[model samples]
Target: MSLILKDLTVSAGKRPLLEIPELVLPAAGFVGIIGPNGAGKSTLLKALAGVVSHGGTKTLDGAWPDAGRIAFLPQDFTVSAAMSVADCVLLGRREHLGWRVTGHDRAEVRRVLSMLDLTPLSDARMDRLSGGQQQRVLLAQRLLRDPRLLILDEPTSALDLHHQLEVLSLLKTLSGGMLVIAALHDLTLAGRFAEQLVLIEGGRVHATDSPERILTGGTLDPVYAIRCEVFRDRDSNPVVVAHPAQGARAGSLER
Candidate 1:
C-alpha cells in the first residue's frame, strides 16, 4: 500500500516549484516534511494531493488508487459556508452517498464529530467557528473519507498548544491504519510522531531519512542558515533549538 512518486514536477508559469526524481513512502506510517520557509514542502504535499498541477506518476501498489481513498487537507482550512457542522462533515462521504441521505452516513458523522471533540458544536454554523475550530471540523471531514493516503499541509498551524498535541497524537494513531504525511514547523513534535522525515530545498529532495538523522545541526543549519541545537525531551524526542548563525547580524534571523 505504499505510495511511490517518480519524476514528479510542479511548475508555476515558467518557474518550477518542486521536483522529485523518486520517492517512496511507506504505508501506515507518519512522515514529516521539513525545510526552510520558502522550501517546497507545501508544493510537494500539494502535488501528492493533486491540489496543484504537476508532472509525475503517483501510484499506490503500482496502480491508481480507488476513488474516495485519498483525502487532502490544505493549510487554508477556512469555511465560509453557512452549513452546519454535521452537514459539512457528512460531505466527506459524498462519493459514496446516495441521492437520499442515509442513517449510516449520519452515524459516521456523529462518530467523527465525537472523535475530534466537536460533538458539542455539531449544531453550530461553519462560518461562526474560530480558525482552529474550522481546522478541526475540516480535518474531521477528511477522516470521514477513510482515506488510505492522507496529505496535510501545516495541519497544526492554527491550534493552541493543547489542541496541537491532541491533533498530532491523534494523527499518529491514525497512521497505524493509513499513510499520513504532513508539513510541520515544530521539529520536536515532528520527531515525536513521524517515523521518517523528508528535507526539501529549492524544489528538490535534499534528503530523506529517519527523524533522528534529518533533524540535526548538520542538516538544518546549512539549509536554514541558522545555528541549531538538537536536544531530547523527557520522552527522548528530539528538541530543536535555533539561534542566530555565528556570523549573522542582529535582526537578520527574523524567520
Candidate 2:
C-alpha cells in the first residue's frame, strides 16, 4: 500500500490551504510532517484522509483505496463529558457494527483499552481523565478500525514528556503495519521516530527526505527565518537547536 498525490490542491472557503505537485508515501512506516504554524501540515493530512475537498489525484497502491481505509485523528478532539472511556473508544467500531453493539464489539473495545493501558479507566467518565490519558483513549478509538493509513495532527500536543515518549514509542512500533503520517511540532522527536520527513511551509511542501537531510540549517532557517544549529545525538540522529531572532535577542538585552 502506497499513497500518491498528484497536483493536489485544497481550498477552504476561497483560500487555498495545501498545494502539492507530487508526493508519494510508502505503505508501512512513520512519516512525519513538520513546519511552522499555518504551514498547511494538518490540511495535507486532511486531504489524504478525504475529510476535505481537494483538486487533484490521490491514489493508494496505484488505485483509489476504499473510503474508510484511512483513519484520521484531528488535533482538537472534544471528548463528550457524559460518555465513558469504553463507550468513547467503542465508537470506532460503529462502521462495522451498523446500529447495534454486539458481543464482539465489546470484546474488541476491551482489547483496544488494554492495548492503550486504558483498561483501568474504561468505565471512567471522559472528563475525569488527564490530558494524556484522554489522548490515549482517542487514539485507542482510532485503532479500533485497524486502518491502513493513520493520519494524526499534533497528536501529542497536550501530553506530558513521559506520555509523549510513550505515545511515540507506541507509534514507532505500529509503523510497520500502517502508513502513519503525523503533524509534529517537536522537531527532535520527529527526527528520532519518523522514517521519512516532509517539511511544509506557506501551503507547499518545502522539502521531503530523511530527517537528517531535511532538518538542517539550510532547509529550516530559510523557512523559519531564525538561525539554527543541527547536531547528532549519541545514537547519531539529527537534533535541531534554534536561536532567537536577532531583533528578539536585542530587545531582550535592552530589558
Task: For model 2, name the residue pairs that clash.
Answer: none
What TM-score would each prediction reach against the true structure?
0.94, 0.92
lDDT of 2 by residue, 128-180 (tens): 77777899999999989888888999999988888788888888898888888
Q: How accurate is candidate 1 locally (lDDT)?
A: 0.88
- Note each model's CA RMSD in angstroms: 3.3, 4.0
lDDT per model, in order?
0.88, 0.86
Worst 10 residues of 2 by lDDT: 246-255
CA displacement after TM-score superposition, residue 114 of candidate 2 (Å) = 2.1
Candidate 1 lDDT tens digits, 1-255: 677899999999999898899998886689999888889998898788777899979987778567588889998789999999999999999888888998988999999999888999999999999999999999999999999888899999999999999899999999998889999988888888899999998988899999888878778887888877787888878888889787854322211
- Model 2 stretches with alpha carbons more than 4 Å out: 98-100, 247-255
- In model 1, the runs with Cα more than 4 Å from the true position are 246-255
